[model samples]
Each structure stands twice: as C-alpha cells, then as structure tokens.
Target: MSAGDLPDPAEMTDQLLDEDTVRQVLTEGTLEISGRLTDASNLTLLAVSSLDGVELECVYKPIRGERPLWDFPDGTLAHREVAARRIAEYAQWDCVPLTIMRGGPYGNGMVQRWIEQPDDSPDLVDLVPAKKIPRGWLPIMRAVDTGGADVAVVHADEDKLKLLAGFDVVVNNADRKGSHILTTAAGGVLGVDHGLCFHTDDKLRTVLWGWAGESLPDSVVEGLARLATGMAGDLRLEMDEYLTVTEIDTLARRIDYLQMSPLYPMPPRGRSAIPWPPL
Candidate 1:
C-alpha cells in the first residue's frame, strides 16, 4: 500500500524515536510521493514516514525492486542488509544503524532510520593537504584533487571507525568504500551500504586496512567475545533468516578466531585488498 494511503499513528516530528516507534512508522507509514533517492545505485531508495503522525525520515530499499546481480541470489540483498545490522548490534558496534526488514510501499525490503548529517563533523573519506599523515588519522589512498595539487584520502583512527572495522571483518563486507562511511550530526561515524556482504568465501574488500595485524584493543575483544557466543548459540538461528548455513558457520569460525587471536587479521595475499575509488 502507498504510505499516503495509510493513517498517521502519532504526531512525532523531530522527536527522538525509539526503536519500536521507528519500526512502526516504517512498517505502516506512507511513502513520500517523490521519496526515491535518485543517486542510489543498484536499487530504488525511498524516503518514507508513518502516516499515523510521526514524521520519521527513513530510507527504504525494497527487495523485489532490486536490479539483478550475477553474484548474489535474487531478492536477498535486503536480508543481508538486515543481517549486517544484527551482527553490528550483537557486537555493540552501533555504527551499523538501526535497520528493519518489513513491508513498504513497494514490497518487503530493508528500512533504516535516517541518520542526521552534521555540518561540523569531519569527513571519513577526505583529502589532506600535507604529505605526512595526521597524528590520529591513517592514509588509505592518495590522488590529486580538483586543484591539481597533491592530496591523500584518509580516515580517522577513532573508536567509531575501529568498531566498524571490527564489525566489517565478521560480516566479510566486500564493498567498504569511503563513501559508505557516514558521519552523524553528533560527530559520530556509522557504516552503511552493507548489501555486498556475508558471503561464505573471504570477500573483505575495504579502505579500512590501516590497522591490519594490530591488536584489537581489549574493549574491542570483549565486544567480539560477546558476539561470538551469540553467533554460535541463538544468533545462528536468527542468521538463517539472511545467511546460508555455510556462511553462518563461517561467521562463527571468524568470531572464534577473532576472540582467540585477538588481533586484526592480515590481508590475504592473493586478492585485491581495497575497493576501487577508495574515497
């Protein structure tokens, strides 16, 4: 049903929306007539809100509306999006954003709460003027900017990025481009666009190789351990909703490996380690 066709449930606008409220608005809200996010690739991106009264801004990517991909099974990318968020939540790495797979104006797809972008926040993938990397940042790639001068694309080595880096490892994210990391208005970082993930094989392409082989700080290890237990136990059952049995088993193995080893993994030698257009 079109979102405009439904009734608004509450008079919520710019109010802090809890998970339940967000989910309800997404599941039952009316879609804006021109809600589609045109710049989105590989699928339609719809902006929607609950008809009941809450004006929640949300991005909806419907499963059936996806463009075909040779590598992934049809209509399954939306589930993987949800699965990535689940893993992120389990590890306490809230960077993945709150996501729900529910019926929308088009069909069943993934709905994520829109994060407000703050003008003052630093860009995750930004160019620097100097040759030397900054104290708390790492250079991922380099190139010239529009001014025909030297510039380097870098990421800050903050806890927010670190949490996302760890989360990406367990999910085997294949498209961790700089564009995928978003900065919230509150100066926090969050990772998005996780459809290309959770393959049984090792497909961890990303721009986050700055800390490869470094020890995952103790806090990171604790978070990983907590997730490992859940992945092996009840989480495995939930994983079935989005992942194949082989993929779930491999995720469990990754969790175990991360907990025991307690180090960032080395990039495998035989493959391209980072994504194209690193910024």
Candidate 2:
C-alpha cells in the first residue's frame, strides 16, 4: 500500500490507531516509558505515545542502549531496523510494522508499532517431536532434545511465511528466530527485532528455511521486482541514510540474484544456518 493508503488498524487486529495516526504518535507524540522487555539483548523499552487523547503502544530501542556487536557498527542497529521496514514497504509485502527512527525518552532510537498477539495465534515456527511433525509444516533440521528424544525444527507451509523468508534473503537477516515471527489476531504475520539485518555479507541465519531449494512464488518474484525497481530509483537514496553504499549495493545484487535463480536459497555451507535458541 502507498503511504497514503495505510492498511486499516482492524487488519492489525489489536492496534486501534491507523497507520498515519500511529506514525504521528511515534514521530510527534509524547512518549511515556512504561516498562522494559528484560529478555531483549538491547535495552528495549515498552512505551506508549499519546497525541490528543489517542494512545499507541510501541517498542523503543534507544541507540545508546544498544550493545555493541563485533560485526555491525555500534549505534547503527536502530537505523537498520528502520531500513528493514522501508525495504518491506518498498517490496509491498507489509511484513513489518510501522517503524521509525526518532528521539525517545532515553535518546535517539528505533520506534516501532507494538504488535499484540492473540493467545490463540498459531505457531509459525516450532519444535515438535521428530516423528510427529505437523501435516502442513516443513522440517528444517532434526536434533536430539535434552531428554534424548528426537525433535525437529519446523515452520508452517504458508505463503505469508514464504514471503517473509524471501524478505530475509534480501536483507541478509542474521537473526530470524521463531520468536521474531509474530502472528496477529487477524492472522497476519509480522517480523520484528531487525537490528541484525541488512549486512553486506552472507549472514542469513534463520529458522524459516523450510522452503529451501523450492521455487519462489510468483508473488514473491513480483515483490523482488518491485524492490529492484525501487533500488534503481528512490529506494537506494532512502536506504543510503541508514546503510553503507556497499551494503545497499549488496542488497541490490541479492535481489538480482534471486530474480535470476527464482528459488529459495540453500543453507550456506560451513556455517550454522539457524540462530541459537531457535525460538
């Protein structure tokens, strides 16, 4: 959808703010720090933005709170998170929520629309008994559990997931654990915590490799084409604000390669293909 045609809040299932209103709240509203997500590697804050009686829930990851990574430049993760959302928007996939880089209570950071997942939302990626992989789930790997029982790493065989997998390939996402995939009450899929994405190298660690070696769906190819078209024009300029020139060039190259091959990439050789603590 175009910037003017933001998807309805109802489609987001739990969000009461429309896209424009949410963006307004994130950009110009009063931010109130409510809590912290302790499990987050960075100092992630749970916050609410209020504007003229409209309140929106959001996650704030301050740049100063970011933990330095040996690979990614310090303080750049927040920018990368915003860039990931831009890429998704360019691809017309809507796989990521509205994300922006702005000043928060702590400091400059990435602010994103908080997704409220319904309790009954289905699991997209999961660990199940090896012998009983769900009917429509594709197994990525098998391992012996701590109890010595065989278990499998699997994800649902759904188009939304396939689209996300394609998105990860383009971004070279270095972390795509099961927990990163959020299923909304509307049954829409949203991916979060993208600080590990958009690297220039082949650090594509993820658990959504269920479709490895499979042909890319026609819709996915169309999305890639859209991204490519953007890369050649405004998208490159936009991403330049966040990623290095080499990184943006590498992303363009990945899009081109995928279009030529039109298949899901195989797990890279000589590397751990999945993230630790897969969920």
Candidate 3:
C-alpha cells in the first residue's frame, strides 16, 4: 500500500496516540495487508489495517516475506528494528517511531506505528538563498551554479533532528535516508524503517551530517552516559535476546565512546559517510 492509502496528517490531532493502547493493538491486532509499497527494497512494504478493539493503520514486514541479504542474516531484521527503537527509547530520544515485533499474517515480523507527517513541513534539506536563511536554521553547505549564483543547503535546527543525529551514531544505523525523517504538525520528528542497525561493525550511513563536528548538547551527553552505565543490567539482557553477544558488546563500546567525547565524531577519511541520494 502507498502513503495515499493512509489518513491525512495535515490536520492536527489533540488526542495522543496512546503508547499503551498502541502496544495492545500492535501485539493483538488483526492485520490487513491489502497491497505492497513498491519503492521499497527486496521485501514487501505493507500498509496494514490493524484492529484489536479499535481500528488503526500500521506498516507490517513479515519475516518470511523478505529477500536475503548477504551481510545480514535472515529473520533478524525484525529484531534489529525493535532493538534500535529500544536503544533510542532508553536514551530518551524518541526519534524512532513506536515499533514492536509480533506474529502476523505470514509469520513473526516487525510492525511500526505509521507516522502521518504533515505535508506542509519543510523538506529536511532544502535550498535557500545564502543571506535569506531564517533564524534557528542551520546552513549545511554552500553551492555555486555554473552561472555563479550561490545558494545554501539548510536544515531546521530542531532539537529532535539533533537528537536523531546522536541517536543514529549510537545505533550504528546504516540506512538513515532522507525519506525516513517524518515530521508532524506539532513539529515532532519521528524516524522510521530501522531494519539495518546495531550491527557489530561500524555501518553508520546517514543523511544527518548537518551537525557533524558540533558539540553534543549537555542533555544528549547525559542520555548517552545513562545508556553506557546500564549496559551491564537490563539493556544487555534485552539486546542479547535478539543480537549476537558480539554486537551487544560493540553497542556498549560505542556508547562508552560517545560518553567520553562532547563533540560529535567526524567522518572517517576516505569513507563514504553520507548515504546515497541525500535528500
């Protein structure tokens, strides 16, 4: 199913999407995969209609419905999705959309609460005249046309987007494409499609390099510290259930490194740091 099949988000909603209610629905809800979203990877991206005690819209990815990846093991992407959200939640970065793994029409899979981003929100990256940038927006880079006219690529300096930058680092997210950043009428930024994350190796490919060398905010550092300190407790246990022991250890190591530095790390030399077709 395409985005056109979902409810419009331009209109505001005062009624919160209750997490507890959503959890119940995602866990026990009846699923309807009426069609497939075509612009996805080898897997079928399903627009699902969920019904437990109430009706809701969601996206479902059944494990048995995916194509194999050489680097990633089969049937583990669902766990990675939930694990990524868990790590983000633990850090109090609510950038990730609410997600859970559950049994579905095909088999156990990942189901994410669909984020109805308001269409009016500005693109995460947009061209702006160099001197006309609004206050609180960050200038990404300057580009000059063949005719020598200059423009700046700018991003909204929203706290949620900054938090998501750090969140991607901690999760080692490998596929944070521009299309994954969802914005709400209330200016909430929710990240989705987190199936390639938390691998043992460094694989942080993302479009969120706007704050590449900036200092981490005090609150963001505090959150990473909390995650680092809790590695021996419930965090380790929860991750162990899905990720390999090596990957879990690597996550703790990454958190430790984040806590040790105040500045966001620079991209490695000779490495392709940003994801392709960056917005």
Candidate 4:
C-alpha cells in the first residue's frame, strides 16, 4: 500500500500509506510527497494551493524534539507556530506569509510562502574563500559594494541591511546563514528558517560582517529601540493569542540588545570556531 493510504498517527496503524508512494518521495533522507494533509507534526510536510492557484509547500511541527540545537526545546511545535505568527505580526511586513491550511497527507501544516531560486546561488558564505577570512574584514568591503556603506554594494540597495536587522529582531533568530538568505532578480533579499528563534539567549549568528564592531546606523538603532519599548503592548495585542509570554519576552530582549549595542562582538576563531549553521 502507498504511504498515503496508511492511517494517521492517532488512528489505527493498518490505515498507513502504501509503501510505493512513500518510497517515491523518499530519497537521500528527504521525502517529497504531494497531497492534502489530514494531520501534521513538526516534521511533516503539507501541500496546499497558493493564492496564485498553484500548489505550494509547507512544514508542520506538531511536537518539539529533545535538546534542540537552537533555543527551541524538543517537541515544541506549538511554540514554532506561535513564533511564526508573531514574526509576521511584529514585522508588519509580509516578508513571510504564514498560512493555516488543511486537507494534506499528514494533516494541517502551517503553509509558509515559498521562495523560488536556483539550487546553487551566490550566498554570503561564498564571499569568504577560506573558513577564516584573511583580512578578517571582507564583509565591510562587500557591504560597501552592496550599498551597505556609503552606497549600495552587493545589489545597490541601501535598505537591505535595515531589513536584515529587522528580520533578526522579529524572529529572535540565532543563526543567519548565507543560505538562509535568498536574493531575487529584483534586488530583494528574503530570510527563511525561523524554527531556531525566539529564545532568551544572546544567540545572534550571521555571515554579514560589515557591521560587526562598528557603529550602527542611527535609523536601524532607532528602529530597534522603538520595537523594544513597544513590544509588550504591541505583542499582546497582535500576537498574544499565538505566542507565549516567554517567546515575546525573548524577542524583546533581542531588540534591546540591538538598541543597546548595535555593533555586536565578532565571533572568535580557532578551536571554538564552527561555521554558522544553515538556517
């Protein structure tokens, strides 16, 4: 029988999907099935029709795991859902379109807007040839080229840095790998993978180095301060139903850090060194 025909977790085991379809989507430790979900968990995948009339992909986490690498606890699926909603609400920006959908192979997974791009794209990590940069300061150079400095350097867009900072705060993201960032032909940069976010830790990690140990722009600093000061009220009114108090508090702390010290310390090299995780 196909895996799709199998019974859901809460149902009898005899109702499981047929083996053939499960194998079809399973390759190299990844599964690619397409169907209307009947139930979902953190590891489950759901396919839904998009506003554009095309089916899209989404992941659902009904339970958390143990000792999660990021701040999130294991088996904390509800927390992830709340965090996603909180980010979408706090940012007041549609950077991520988090939707609730039903009728999938697994069940109901939070359907996030999908970004289309080539499998191999130039990522910020590529800017550094070796694990350690020779000059220990190439990001500033790239930023300058992308208009991160006096002018837009990479994509000739000055506002990119600001948006990046905003995303970091909204998600309380601990890791911001180059792969997590998607660049569009229109010069837009998008961020993804917020599962490891909204934790009360100083876990900000990223590939951008231009602003490290440097004074932050007044505009960005001010924006962080504004968010920090109004987080409690804003979050309560906007995301209270979805997010927990702890999650909101963690987001507030991240904003506070940005406001208090815009320029964070650089990561130390050597034995304690590890490449940023692909978030």
Strongest candidate by TM-score = 2
User: Model 3, range 93-199, lDDT digits (tens) per residue?
Assistant: 77887788888778788888777767687687666788888787777556785678897767777777888888888889888877888887777788887888888
Candidate closer to the true structure by lDDT (higher is better), 1 or 2? 2
Which segments of model 3 are wrong by more than 4 Å?
Answer: 1-15, 127-154
Per-residue lDDT over 1-279 for candidate 2, one digit per residue giving the tens place of the 0 to 100 score: 233444444454325556766787678878999999999999999999766555678999999999999999999999999999999988888799999999978999999989988888888898999999989899988999999999999999999888899888889899999999998877899999899998887999999998899998877899999988999999999998999999999999999899899998999989999999899
Q: TM-score: which is higher, 1 or 2?
A: 2
Q: Please, what are the lDDT tens digits per residue for candidate 1 over residues 160-215? A: 78878888887899889988898876666889889989887899988888888898
Root-mean-square deviation (CA) per prediction: 3.8, 3.4, 5.6, 12.2
Better of 2 and 4 by lDDT: 2
Q: What is the C-alpha lDDT of each candidate?
A: 0.78, 0.89, 0.76, 0.47
* Best candidate (score: lDDT): 2
Tell me the deviation in Å of residue 151 in model 2.
0.9
By lDDT, the candidates rank as 2, 1, 3, 4
Cα TM-score per model: 0.88, 0.94, 0.84, 0.58
Measured by TM-score, how close is model 2 to the native structure? 0.94
List residue ranges in candidate 1 displaced over 4 A. Answer: 1-15, 129-132, 143-150
The segments of candidate 2 whose C-alpha lies over 4 angstroms from its true place after superposition are 1-16
- Misplaced by over 4 Å in model 4 are 1-46, 50-71, 81-85, 92-104, 118-122, 127-162, 241-243, 268-279
Give the local distance difference test score of model 1.
0.78
